[model samples]
Target: MRRADRLFQIVQYLRGGRLVTAHMLAERLEVSDRTIYRDIADLQSTGVPIDGEAGVGYILREGFDLPPLMFTRDEIVALVAGARMVRAYGGPAMARAAEEALVKISAVLPDTERARIDRTEIHMPLWVVSEEERRTIDTLERAVEARHVLKIDYRDEAGASSCRDIRPLGLWFWGKVWTVVGWCELRGDFRAFRIDRIASITCDGRVFKHERGKQLADFYRQMERDEAARDWAHRRSQNAP
Candidate 1:
């Protein structure tokens, strides 16, 4: 679990004037007692109203409540517009989660901010992406998260078909299409397959480990280098005259 999430859980466990022990918090959060102690100290330093020490126990003082979320006007507009786009173009589970996020944002915002969300003019046509492609996207997303090796039958733009076993690294959305970028076992290199061009994809029940020069960071670095090379070539061509 993320440290932020663990800290939040620690706070929740100490609520209602309950004296929660460091050991108890550690066990519940699957972390060390030292981590809980550090977290408690950090929370105390941040004026979280946590009372008590490492050995004894800790309690969140009564009347202490988390502050409401605050967002600037531009932040609200961007969030609402992005959520609407995801709801329209993302997978079924993704769409539902985006909808819930929008609802939660609206529920927490002040009345004026909530009104701004409704007034945000950005919208997306729901029919732009087919249901089949959405399902494919969902599958690939799960595979990427799980670090699973996927066996995919893909047809390229020129109608060439090939089956590949790939270590799913990440998904990239290019406005209208979704592409799964992975380290292709067949090609012995990184390859990106469009979701629409994927005829079939299934997990091979094999999880992959991060290897040197094959991870997502490596892919991004490669992309940056390629882009820089293209820019240099463009500049060279323009200066030729």
Candidate 2:
């Protein structure tokens, strides 16, 4: 964590109106108690309404609004890398928005920070992902964010085709490919749809509520169980042979 980001997190941690101890803050930020002490003093000197004793804890004064965003060098690097990845995989509209946002971030930052951003060497190559694939990712991202049900014409590896109304939950990138995980109304189960395999997609316009077993956490739990079962089967097969 950068000093600037650490300071911002301190404010956020303190904002919940509790006396958070130095040890707690240091532990959360993966820094030393001495560092937290110094950071607190620096923040107070800058007129931030942070009040506390050394051993007891610190709390932010009520009615104090957070100042503008600040980033340390490492945080800026992370931000830029993330934005670049979005540009690499998130398609044209998203790429344009990310670029514009980076421009705005650069404008607000000091020359030192801007220079750091310019000098940063992190890069992701966009080699084989086409404009159409990126557009599909963009469309799926919009659907997930908006909680829109998607009606998709899909094809599997055997060239079997199916149409399904999918309650979009999340989108994931697997290096060379992109996947959208969702609740498939037809199968009555969660399914992972490769965006590349989706023949066509349209809005279903039905805003169905996410039931208890149909959320992302549920999907993760199911995946874990499947992996565990596969491992168990492999071990049993070895013992049998």
Point to the candidate with the largest lDDT.
Answer: 1
Candidate 2 matches the true fold with a TM-score of: 0.68
Give a tens-digit lDDT track for model 1, residues 1-241: 8899788778889988778899999999999999999999999989999999878999999998776678999999899888988888899989998989899778768786788888989989999889999888889889888888989999999999999999989888998989889999998989988989999987759999999999999999999999999999999999998
lDDT of 2 by residue, 100-219 (tens): 889878876876678777887888888657888888888888888788988999999898999999999998889888889999999999999988899999995767677899999999
In angstroms, the error of model 1 at 13 is 4.6
* Displacement of the residue 141 alpha carbon in candidate 2, Å: 1.2
Question: Which candidate's TM-score is highest?
Answer: 1
True-vs-predicted CA distance for residue 162, candidate 2, Å = 1.5
Runs in model 1 deviating more than 4 A are: 13-34, 51-58, 224-241
Error of 2 at 153 (Å): 0.8
